[model samples]
Target: MADSRSGRSDSDALIRVETLAKRYETAAGTTPPALNGVDLAIQPGEFVAVMGPSGSGKSTFMNILGCLDTPTSGAYYLDGRNVAELSDDELATLRNRLIGFVFQGFNLLKRISVADNVALPLVYAGEGKSERRRRALELLDQVGLAAHADKQPNQLSGGQQQRVAIARALSNHPRLILADEPTGNLDTHTSEEIMDIFTRLNRDQGITVVLVTHEADIAHHAKRLVRFRDGNVVYDGGVKGI
Candidate 1:
């Protein structure tokens, strides 16, 4: 099926998949399928949400999209690079350079200062200490956490901690942002705030965002929505209000 878009340019596909399938085989030779022959295309600067009920394979899709796992079959082209062709180490390096991840739990180092937490990705990227600190401060400021950069995770509110997590995700200046229930831990108001931040980043920074969420209200914030059922995409379309 052809992926539809609203006046998108021809030369801007950030991710593409064809007949993507995933399955797991245990030691006992019991095989359970996860994804079944899915095809999708995501363009640059697009904000897309993958929504489904539990056990619907959307989680498996997210894992593959994030490069945290590989598909058992089919092809996945991420930023023009074939996922199946890359070595494990190459995939790790590609993930470090191209993907920024935000999880539901706000995965930050609990004992570190917010600044240090935000700098962790840069550290992995081999950024110098001074440069890491400088960039981390800039990202914290962007997320409105500069004033509290010295605080530990326990010192910040839920929303603030999630913001720090976001800054850490962005430290690599990745082309794609993969957020898996990023607002799951926040209150309604905090969730709205975080969603606003994501929307702004997608719009202003031209970052492609793939969000996995169960909430329709949360999914509405995305430009597009793709629903999964029975290990396959059931619907891929634009959100009603744009």
Candidate 2:
């Protein structure tokens, strides 16, 4: 029964979008707007799920939230700073410092050891080699993958690989996690295990989680659900009775 409207004060919101819209250009001409007049506010330490059918604009909205794409018009603010106002370098730094990304593909580097792969983000942040290795091992331990740290990606099962991916995502100690179909490729049991990990992270660490999923059961893991249809949010409320 909580108010689901995006009318919360901007000063307290961790993420906010106002009148957001996006359009894609095709060879024929501009396509209809992928997103239209969307308004949302996500606070820190909350878990939210987004659901929609194909081409319903859920993916577009996630991309914009992740800073991988921009809205053609309107405003997006992250951590109290307007996204459009930051320079490219500043944006990159902000993203690195504030967000962690998890994807369906696992996205681990097959060429490296699991620990090294987890350490990749620290490398970009310019941590020393020994320090990176130490931190990577620590994260691997947190994910219950410490025993597999020296092994290559191919040596692990799909679920284990995804655990490594989750560990890697946490390497930078980001405050927010943006997960896009994180359990899509896993089997039902494996998917549940992955979701459990995410749930623990949110509950124990107070990290804000925003996830996109097509499955009702998966969306049920979140405390709040936001459903999109035809570039609009048709539902935004508690997950129960959805």
By TM-score, the best candidate is: 2
- Writing each residue's lDDT as its tens digit, candidate 1 over 137-232 gives 999999998999888888999899999999998999998999999998888899999999999999999999999998888999998899999898
Ten residues in a row with the worst lDDT in model 1?
1-10
Q: Which ten residues in a row are the worst by lDDT in model 2? A: 1-10
TM-score to true structure, per model: 0.93, 0.96
lDDT against the true structure, each candidate: 0.89, 0.91
Show where candidate 1 strays beyond 4 Å: 1-11, 27-31
The deviation in Å at residue 43 for candidate 2 is 0.5
**In the order shown, what is each candidate's alpha-carbon RMSD?**
2.2, 1.4
Candidate 2 pairs with clashing backbones: none
Instruction: Please report how far candidate 1 places residue 77 from its true position, in Å.
Output: 0.5
For model 2, what is the C-alpha lDDT against the true structure? Answer: 0.91
Model 1 steric clash pairs: none
